[model samples]
Target: MTAERGVHKPNLLVLVGPTAVGKTRLSIEIAKSCSCEIISGDSMQVYRGMDIGTAKITPEEMQGIPHHLIDVLDPEESFSVAYFQKVCRSLIPEIASRGRIPFIVGGTGLYVESVCYEFQFTEAGADEAFRQEQLRFSEQFGPEALHAKLTEIDPETAAKLHPNDQRRIIRALEVYHLTGTTLSRQLESQTKASPYNLCIIGLTMDRQLLYNRIEARIDEMVQQGLVQEVKSLLERGCSRSLVSMQGLGYKEIAEHLLDGLPLEDAIMKLKRDTRRFAKRQLSWFRHMKDIHWIDVTRGENFPDHLADIRAIIAGKFGIPLEYNYKH
Candidate 1:
C-alpha cells in the first residue's frame, strides 16, 4: 500500500495495470534505460507454449534484454502466488548482484501485489475432497457461478478474481472449507514479512482506448495462431480444466472447440471478456493506495509519457534514469 520505496536499499520496480494499455512496450523502454532485466509478472506467460494468447514478447521483441519467469513452467503444472513470490525473492537478489535493476511487468495485480506489498503465502496444504467438490462445482456451474459462491463466503477473494479464473475460484472455496477460515484472514495471519523495499508504477489509459486495444490485440493473437497453440497444448496432454487452461483466452477458445459455438463468436466473447477483465484490473488497482498512476492517454506524445515516468522514478529512487543499455 505504501509507495515510499525506502532509500539505501536495492530497488524493485513493478509496472502493472489493465491489459492492452501498452505495458509490455513501456516496460521494455524503461528497462532499456534503467539497465534492468525484465521479470514477467503475468500468470499465463509462464507456460512455454502459451505465447501468442498470453501476448508474450519474443526475444526479438525484447530487443536483447533478458527476461525471466516467462516460460519456466509446463502448461499442466500448478502456479500460485506463493510460487511466484518465492521465485521472485530468489531472482531479484541475483539480478541486483549483477548490478541491473529488477523490473517486474505484467497486468496480473495479485502477482504484483504479492511482491510489492510483501504479502505472505500461507500453506495449509490441500484438501482432496474439498478440492474435488469445488472442482465439480466449477465444472457443472462454471467459473462465474463458483465465483458467486466465493462472494457469498469470501467477498474479498471473490472481488479480486475474474469470473473466468476457475482455478482460483476452486482454490478459494477449497481453502475456506479445508481450513475453516476465509482465505483473506489466513493470508493476513500467515504473511511472512518481506525485506525488499519496493516501488510500484501502474500504467492506465482511457477506457474506450483500452477496450479497443484489447479487442485489436485479441484479433492479432488469433491471427498469430492462438488456436493452434491451444491445440498443441491439448495434444501435449493439457486438459481443458487444467490450471493453465483457465487463463482468459485459453478457456474461451477451448469452450468454443468443445461446444458448438463458432470460433468467431468465441473470439468476440474473448475480446469482450478481456476488456471486462482489464476494467476489473483497474478497479482493483484503484483500491490500493499510494499507486503512482500514469495516464498514457493524457500524454500528448510518447516522449512526454516517458518524461513523466522518468521523473517519477528519479524522484522515488534518487537515481538518474540514464544507465548503460548498451551492455
Candidate 2:
C-alpha cells in the first residue's frame, strides 16, 4: 500500500451501487488498473448452488483477478452482516500485505458499510426457541405481520429491510428481545470510523433505464435456466425457507415452481421486486460518506466513465494509473 501523507491506514477500494447498474463490469476494470484483490460485498453470492440467479461471477469473467467470499457456503448455511464484517475485516490487511489493494465490490449496502466503517453490532445471544417461535409467527401470520412487530420495536431497521427479509427481521427482533434495546439504537451508537484509507465509488444511472436493465437481466437469467436452478435446489431438499432461498430471484421462482404460479407472473414479480431492491440499495449507499458518485447513463461511452473513475482513484490515493483513451 502506498502511504498517503497523514493516513497511516492501509488502502481500501470500494465500488458500490444498486443492482443492474453495472458495478460488476466497472469493478473488474478498476481492479485491473489498480492491482486489487476483490472481496465481494454481495450477501447472496456466497451460496454455492445459487449461480445464475445471484449473478455469480464466472471464472472467465474474473480474468485472473482473485476474488474472495463468493460461493463459500452451502444453501443451508446462514450468512449475516456481522459475519461478513468479521471476515472482511481480516481480509483487508491480508490482501494489502500481499501488495494488492483490497477492493470490495457489490450492492449489499449494510454489509459493505459495516466493513468500511468498522460497525459494532450488539453481542446479543441467540435463542433457538425464540427464533423458532418468531418463525412460527411469521409462518402463521405472514411475514408482513412479523415485520409489523419489528416496526413497533425498531422502525428504522424495519424501514430498511423488506418485509420478506425474514432472517434479518427475526434477528432484529431477537436483539430487542435479548437486550431490551432496539437494534437501530445499537447501530446508531457505532463510531462510523474506518481502519483503512478508503476510496469509495458509487455508480448510478437514469432510474427508468436502470429498471429496464434490471428487467433485461431477469429475462437473461430465465433463459439461462433460473427456474431449473431453483428447482435443483428444491429437489436437493433445500427448503424455500432458507435464507439463500429468500433472495429475490430464488423467492419468486420458488413461488412459481412450488406454488403453481405461472412462470411469466413470477418473472414479472422478480423484475418489480428487483427494481425496488435497487432503489433501496441506492438509498442506503447515498447516506454513506465520501462516495465519489459517477453517472453511467451513457453506457455507450464506457471508456469515458472508466477514465473518470481512474482519475478518482488516482486522485484519492495519489497513485498513477495507466490508461489509453483510444481503446
Candidate 3:
C-alpha cells in the first residue's frame, strides 16, 4: 500500500501490546530479522534517568540494533503526542532513506496511533496565561472544580477524561478558550489516514498469565531500586507535578517518599495500577484496525512465536525474513 504522496512512503512495522506482554525481546528479534532500526513509541521512555520504571530497553538488550527516541528528554521536560508525531514523521523517513525498515515499537497506543493515523493536532496556539490561570484554578478550587468547568464547555471530552488528569483537562479548556472549538470537536475533524504502509502486530496472552507478568515485572522493578530512581529525580529538583514524574512506577513510589504513604502500600498500589494500565493498553489497541494478533502463552516455545511473527511480516509486507533462529 503506497501513499498518495508523489514520493514513496516506506513500510512501517509496528509491534504494540499491553505492558509486560513481551514486546521488547520480540521486537529486537524482529528488527534483526527485518534489518530495521527501532523507534520507541513509548511516552515515558523518552525521559532520561527513567530506565527501571519505563522498562526501557538497555544497550545490552538492544544488542547493537539502533534505537531512537529513548532517553532524549530530562525528567523535568514535557512530552506530548503532538511532539511524538512530529519526531516520528521525521525519523521514519530518515530510517527508510538509509534502507532499513522503521519499527515503531511500544505499548503507547495514542502515541503510535497518532503517527500511523496521521492525526492533525489543533492549530490553535497555546495561551500560556490561560494555562497558568487554569493551573492556579485547579490548585485553589481542586481538580474536580476545574473538571466541572470542562463539563460546561466540552462535556463530551470531560466525560472521557478523569478529574485527576489535570493536564489534559487544562489543555482541553485552553483549546476552547483559544479557538472557540472544543478539543473533542477538533479531534473529530482530524484525518485518520496514514502516509506509510503499515503492518501492526499486537501481542497477547491468557489474561491471568498477562496479569502475572505485570506483577512479576513490578516486582523486578522494585528489586531494581525503583524507589531510589524516583528519589534521584526528586533530589535533582524534578517536581511530582511534571508529566514525567507522573508515570506509573515513578508516581506511586514518589507518593511513598514525598506524601508519606507506607512503602508496602506504595508497592501494592504500583502493582495494582500497572495491572490496570495493562488492561487500558489492551483496550486501546483493540479499537485499532488491521492489527495481526499473536498469542504467546506462558511456557510456550519462544522461537516458534518468533517464527510465526517472521512469517506474517514476510507474507503481509513482502519483507524478507532473514532471522537466524537456531532451533
Candidate 4:
C-alpha cells in the first residue's frame, strides 16, 4: 500500500499487546503526545470492583490524561462486543470533536478488532418457539449435540469456536432461528466496511521475556491482594462460570480457593495459563496485517522508542505527535 494509505487516516492510536507487556505506560505517553484520550480494550478491566486482578491503572499511573470505559460495568452484568462497539462509537467521535485523538489501548484482541473493523451487527428478533427448541436440545441432547447442530448449519464458525463455547454456539443457533441467516452470514455482513480510519500499534517482546513479565506481574498481583479481590467478587455472588471469573488469573485462583488446591498450585496454574493466553493472543493477532509492530526489548531508551512511535503515527496517520524534550 502507498504511504498515503497508511498516513492519511484520522488517528485512532490503538496500542495493544499480550498481557503485562507495558501497553499501559506506552499508551500514556502516546495519549499525552497526541492530545488524545485513552479508551480501554481489556474485557476484564471494565468491571467496577475487580481492579487488582484486572491490573487496572491507578490515578497516579494515568498521569492526568482522560480515560474512558474502564471500571464501568458491574461484574454480574453481561458485556458483549456489541456493547463495547456502542461505547467506543460514542466516545471516539466525542474525542475527535474536541480535536484530540482517541487511542484504543489494551490486550484484548477481539474487543479491539471489533471496534477497529466496525464489524456490522444484525438485529435478530428471537423466535421463542425455536429458542425453546434449542434449549431443550441442549438439555436432553447435551451441549455437544447442540454444537453438532451448529456445525451442520455454520461449519466455518464452528471450526474456530470450541464445542464447549456454549455462549457463542447458542448465539449462532439464535441467529439462525431469529433472522434465518446463518451465523457465518451475519459475520460476512458485518465485514461490509469499517467506519473509522484506524492506526493499529502492536507491542511485542521476545517470547520468553514477555512470559517472564507476565509471571512477574502475576506475582505482583498476588502481593497486591488479587486473592482478596476475587474473594470479594465471590462475596458479591458472582459464580465461577461467569465471564469475569473466566479471566486467566481469576479462574485458577477460584478453583484453588474453592476446590482445595494449594495456593501455590493455584498461582502456578495462573502463571501457566497466562503464558498460554499470551500465546493465543499472539496467534489471534498474527493475521492482523495492518498493525505496526513495536518491539521494546531494552529496558532503557523509553524516549527513543516513544519518538519512533510518534514519527510513525505522524507519518502514517497525519497527526502531529508531541514529545517532551526530556522525559
Candidate 5:
C-alpha cells in the first residue's frame, strides 16, 4: 500500500526481482539515496560458503551500506521462511529506529512475502520419518516424481513450485500428510494485513534478455570457480540433501563435482534451472499486491532508471533523496 501509513507504523521498503535482473547494484544506489539498510530476501545467500553461486555481496560491493541475513548460517544448517520472517521483523524496526529505511532486496518471493504480510505458517506437525521417506523417494525417482506427488495432493501450490525445488515440494507434501489439508488452503486462510507501512518495488526486463543474462552469469560463475565452491562445501561434509545444496547453482554443480555429471551438462542444467527459477519468481511476485514494477531492459540506461526509482521511493515515503541529476 503506502510507504508510511502513519507515525504508528514503521516503514518497509522492498525491492524484488528475478535473478540476474540487476537488483544488487540498483539496490545499493537506492539504499545510499534513502539511507537504508538492506536485508537480503534470498534463501541461499544466508549460507556462508555459497558465495559465488548465490551472488553474495562482497564487502566492497556493499559500499558501506549495512546488509543483514547474509552469510549468517553454515551450508549444513537449514533456513526456512519462518526464520526469515522472525529475523527480518526484528530488524525492520531496529533499522527504522536508527532513522534508516529497512530495505528488503532479492528474488526470494515467498520469503519476502511472508515478512511483508506476516504470513502465519500453520503449526502442522512435521513427520521426520515421512520427510525422510519423501526425500528418499525424490532421490530414487527424481524430483519430478516427488513434485507429481504434491500435485496430486495440492495442485495449486505445486504449480508455483519448480520440480527442482525439492525442499518446498517435500514440505508441502509433509503438510498434507500431517494435516490432511492443502498447504495452499492454509496460505489462503492467513491474513494479508501487513504490520509495516510498505513500499514494494519489482524489477523486470525482457524475458529473452533475462535468460541471456542468466546464462552469461552462470558462465561468469564457472570462470569464478563454481565447481570448486561446491567441491569445498562437499569436502566439508555438507550433504547433497541439505537445503543449501538444493539451490539452483549449487545443486547442478554439486552433481558435476560428486556424481560425475559432465561439467558442460551441469552448466547447461544450471542455466536452464535458473531460467525456470526466474520465471517462477515472476509468477509468484505477480500475485502479490501493490508492487510498482519497473522495466530495466536497457542496461545502458540504468542511471535514468535509478533516478526514476529514487523518485518513486521519495514520493511513496515522503522523504528527501540526495542525488545529482544529469541533463
Candidate 6:
C-alpha cells in the first residue's frame, strides 16, 4: 500500500525456515539491503536471558539493524499468539511509516500466520479456575490423559497439537469451556485477508543436510555454554515449569539439572528434539499457501545464495537490490 509520503511499502517481508537453517545471517543481509527492520516471530526469543538455547542474535551480530520482540518478556511471564499478533500488526505500519520495510523473521508458524491472516481472537479470556483445574488434572493423571479430554471434545485441533504441549492444550480446552466452540472452528470463521501486501519467502535444504545442520548447531550451542545459560536462569529464580524453560534446549537441560539425568543424555535428547522441531516447522510451512521456497542446498557459495534471494525479493516485492538503511 502507499504510505503518506507517496512511497509504496509492502505490509511485510517475511522470511521463515526451520531452526539452524541460516535464517539469522540472511535476514540481517536482507534487512540491510531493503532498509527494513526485523521483528522476531520466535516464541522462545521473546524471553530475556534466553540467548544460547534460543540462538538469539547478539547486538554485534544484528549489525545495527533494528529488531523488535526479542528479549521483551521475563521467563515466568506468559505470551500468546493474540499478543504477538497485536504487537506485530501495530509495528508493521509504524515501521513502514518511517520509510522502512518490516520483516517478520522466525520459525514460529502460529505467530507468523496469525499476523499474516489477521486472526480475530474470540472475546473469551482465560478461565483461571479452569486452568488450574486442568493443571492439577494433568499433574495427577499425566499429560496424555489431559490431551485425551481435548481429543474427545475437539479432535481436529487436538490432532494438530502435541500431547505434551500443555499450554496450548490447556488454552484449547479453556476456549472450548468458555465459548462452547472449538478453537479451530472459531479460527476457521475469521477472515483470512491480510491488510498489507505480504511477500513470504521460505528456505529449505536437503533433509540430510538440514539434520546435519541441526546436530552441528546443537553441538555449537553446547560449546557456547548452553548448560551454564540454563543454570543461570534457574539460579535467577526461573522454574522448570515456566513455559520459557520448556523450549527445546532449555527443557532438556533443565531435565538434566533438576531430575539428575546425565549431561550427555540430556544433550542427546536436545539434539533429537531439535531435529523433530525442525521437521514440524517444515510441515507447518508446507501447508501454508504462497510461499516462494528457496532451496539453499542448490548452491554452495553464500554470496550466490544471497544473490538469488535478493533477486527473488526484487522480483516479488519490488524492493531494490540496494537501499539506504533507516537509522
Per-candidate TM vs. native?
0.91, 0.96, 0.89, 0.83, 0.96, 0.90
Point to the candidate with the largest TM-score.
5
lDDT of 5: 0.90
Q: Which residue pairs show collisions in model 4?
A: 7-316
Clashes of 1: 0
Q: Write the per-residue lDDT of candidate 5 for residues 1-327, one digit (tens) a residue.
A: 343374667889999999999999999988887899999999999999799999889999999999999999988888988889999878998998898999999899889999999999877867879989998998799989999999988999999998988889988998889888898998899789988878899999999999999999999999998989989989999988788988888889888888899999999988988999999999999999989999999998999898888888888777778885443
Q: Arrange candidates by TM-score, descending.
A: 5, 2, 1, 6, 3, 4
* Number of clashing pairs per prediction, in order: 0, 0, 0, 1, 0, 0
Model 2 off-target regions past 4 Å? Answer: 1-7, 324-326
For candidate 3, lDDT tens digit of each residue in 37-76? Answer: 9999899999999999999999999999999999999988
Candidate 6 residue pairs in clash (backbone atoms < 3 Å) = none
Better of 1 and 5 by TM-score: 5
Stretches of candidate 5 above 4 Å error? 1-4, 324-327
- Report the poorest 10 consecutive residues by lDDT, candidate 2: 1-10
Give stretches of model 4 more than 4 Å off: 1-10, 124-189
Q: How close is candidate 6 to the true structure, as a TM-score?
A: 0.90
| Candidate 5 or 1, higher lDDT | 5
**Error of model 5, residue 132, in angstroms:** 1.6
Candidate 3 Cα errors over 4 Å, as ranges: 1-7, 127-164
Which ten-residue region of model 4 has the weakest summed lDDT?
1-10
The residue pairs found clashing in candidate 5 are: none
Pick out the ten consecutive residues of candidate 5 with the lowest summed lDDT: 1-10
User: lDDT by residue for model 4 over 59-175, one digit each (tens)?
Assistant: 999999999988898888767778898999889889988988889988777778888888777777546577567667876888789889989989977765555455557768888
Per lDDT, the best of the predicted structures is 2
Better of 5 and 6 by lDDT: 5
